[model samples]
Target: MMASARFLIPLGIFIAVAAFLFKGLSLDPKEVPSPLIGKAAPEFSLPLLNDFEAPFANGDMTGEVWLLNVFASWCGPCLDEHPIIVNFARSTAVPVVGFNYKDRPRAAKQWLNRHGDPYTQVVVDLNGRIGLDYGVYGVPETFLIDQQGIIRYKKIGPLTQMDVSQDIIPLIEELSQ
Candidate 1:
């Protein structure tokens, strides 16, 4: 009886761990929770894509709600998500800041020229330090910052039309008020 009890305990533990692993696998990777939500967004000052003469900074939007979109010329998902961003920007009063992540200035400029630039201001993040500060794990992440500069929402993957209409737009309306 004593020997059987020890064997059963290990088997039960293995089953529990397997159950947890299965549950984790079923969950969506894009829904990864951010620690920055409800916290103040990290401040950054970076060169503009159009005019690098004067840098654009997060502080410039101090009292307004805005969207920060992290993107790069080399990232395929950024290309997929660009059109959705362009349409969303037109429908809202909130400013959309494009964070150009870790791409050459000339390539980034040309990519924007080809794809159509939708940003209110495009900020260049040459080294990705600003992205690191914002806890960016991948390209095509987006953050919605409230009027007081607190991060209200963080979308880990590409923005979808349904995402903006269902999750983001309602939140923006709520935060704007």
Candidate 2:
């Protein structure tokens, strides 16, 4: 009976670990919850990519529902999400503000030129300090902010057409009211 009990204990432990691993594998990484949701977005003053002589601050966005897209020239996912952002910007539904994360101004400008600029205002975070303040795990994370400047939602990965049509546009319409 003792020998049988010992074998069963190890078998039970292995089964438990295997279950957890399987569960984790099925979960989407992009669905990870962010603590910043429903909270005020972090404030920062950074230079605009187009008008480097002038500084843009988060405070300027007060009384507006906006989308803040954290992107970098080097991030491949950012490129993938660029078109969706451009479509959003073109729609005039909500202003799209960009936080250029840890990238050179020249490269960012060139990339935008090539892909087309979607941002109404593009702020440069050369040192990534602003990104840190926003709890950014990586580039290409997007936040939807309400009129009060509170973060309403965070999309952690590249934006898809479905994400924009189903999630973002509907939320913007809801928030606008």
The alpha-carbon deviation from the true structure for residue 42 of candidate 1, after best TM-score superposition, in angstroms, is: 0.7
How many angstroms is residue 60 displaced in model 2 relative to the true structure, after the best TM-score fit? Answer: 0.6
lDDT of 2 by residue, 12-76 (tens): 99999999999999998767689999899998899999898999999899999999999999999
Candidate 2 — which residues are off by over 4 angstroms? 1-23
Q: Weakest 10 consecutive residues, lDDT, candidate 1? A: 25-34
Clashes of 2: 0
Question: What lDDT is reached at residue 155 by model 2?
Answer: 86
Q: Candidate 1: list runs displaced more than 4 Å.
A: 1-25
In order, what lDDT does every prediction score?
0.91, 0.90
Per-residue lDDT over 149-176 for candidate 1, one digit per residue giving the tens place of the 0 to 100 score: 8999999888899889998999988877
